[model samples]
Target: MSDALVTHQDIALRLAIPLEKAHEPRVNTLIQDSEELIQDAFAEVGRDYRLEVANLLQRRAIIRVIREMVATAVIVGPYSGARSVNSSSGPNSDGLTWDKVPEVSFAGVKLTDAHRRALGLVVGNDFAPSWNFPPATRWPLRGGDN
Candidate 1:
């Protein structure tokens, strides 16, 4: 996403860190605020279609950011995508309320607001079950499974 790339690059330039390796926790602060702005924009709109569009874009952005950075930094997920729709249900149905469709969990350290926004820039607000990131006893934050 251009928004994420631009934000990531800005941090890289200001910190004199490589574009690929800049410390993101610091820069993502501004990004999170901007995303909140987008949400606010949706709130002002009168149409459901317009609001849903914004929500889709935000989710895509979150997915992109997480997919890109998770390899090196450690992340936790082998999460499932949304399940197939049920033919019996009407086309507008929310698919099966199946108990085990999406497999999200904490991927590693629960990201701080800084990191969470950064990750959100990747995955939006979509829930993800379970993250398979390597254990980080050294990281100040730890997932509860320990």
Candidate 2:
């Protein structure tokens, strides 16, 4: 019944968490936070995305994106800011050495360009060929009747 595009059930499925686990208070907060982030992102772009989700297909697409966002946040957890673990090893003389740490981590979920496209928030440019025409008629310039 919440206004969030996705439900706890959806997040649970994505995260492979139990239904009861997904119902945890923190899970609900994560859902709300993800929804707000999406709304704010659209608002920043001067788009009323809520209005655009009127279509059933469009709504589903947005919901899918929101659910994924929440699930990602849950997987990352609040304490840990790691978006991905490149590689890990257990007890070695070499010890644990990170080849590279990402500049940004999934502390919070943000809409990606792919998500925007899937949500129909981004409009593709028309690549059809176009020509500029003179104000005057081309026939007249071609020596036709003025």
Candidate 3:
């Protein structure tokens, strides 16, 4: 089993975000979000083996999820702009309107093929099953042994 795994500091370093003690909560949340998906994708892999998987590849996967989450947060967060003046009070026609604002949605993240392979998860094209039985020698082994 691998001894080391991805950490919040590793993610911050990967994304070039300034690491602060105060950011730990948010970072931990992000890691938890990514880990849930990771766990689902790699359900067949034992927890111990998962820790031993390629650290770089796992970190990359986590980084992708983190980036998506950060983008969604920014989009849904408050908008920073100048104070708006009442359009009916002045002759000026310049103003911001929400009539054409597009709907914002945060689609949950999915594990990529690379990420799955790195974490020892089965790929869609690969059909090998994890069976414990020995291979059969012959097809017909019923009544007589001749």
The candidate scoring highest on TM-score is 2
Stretches of candidate 2 exceeding 4 Å from the true structure: 1-3, 19-23, 78-106, 123-146
Give the C-alpha miss distance for residue 79 in model 3, angstroms: 14
User: Alpha carbon lDDT of residue 57, candidate 3?
Assistant: 67
Q: Which ten residues in a row have the lowest lDDT in candidate 1?
A: 71-80
Give the per-residue lDDT digits (tens) of candidate 1, residues 26-120: 33644454445444433544324244445766556543443333321222123323244455455554544334422232332123334345433
TM-score, prediction 1: 0.23
Q: Estimate candidate 1's alpha-carbon lDDT, on a 0 to 1 scale.
A: 0.41
Tens digits of lDDT, candidate 2, 15-134? 775656635676677677767766776787787876756778977887888777667666644434433444446653333333322221345565666676776665455344577666
Question: What TM-score do all the candidates reach, one by one?
Answer: 0.23, 0.58, 0.38
Count of backbone collisions within predicted model 2: 0
Q: After superposition, how far is residue 19 of candidate 2 from its true place, in Å?
A: 6.1
Candidate maximizing lDDT: 2
Q: Considering TM-score, which of the candidate structures 1 and 2 is the better prediction for this target?
A: 2
CA shift of 128, model 2, Å: 13
Sort order, TM-score high to low? 2, 3, 1
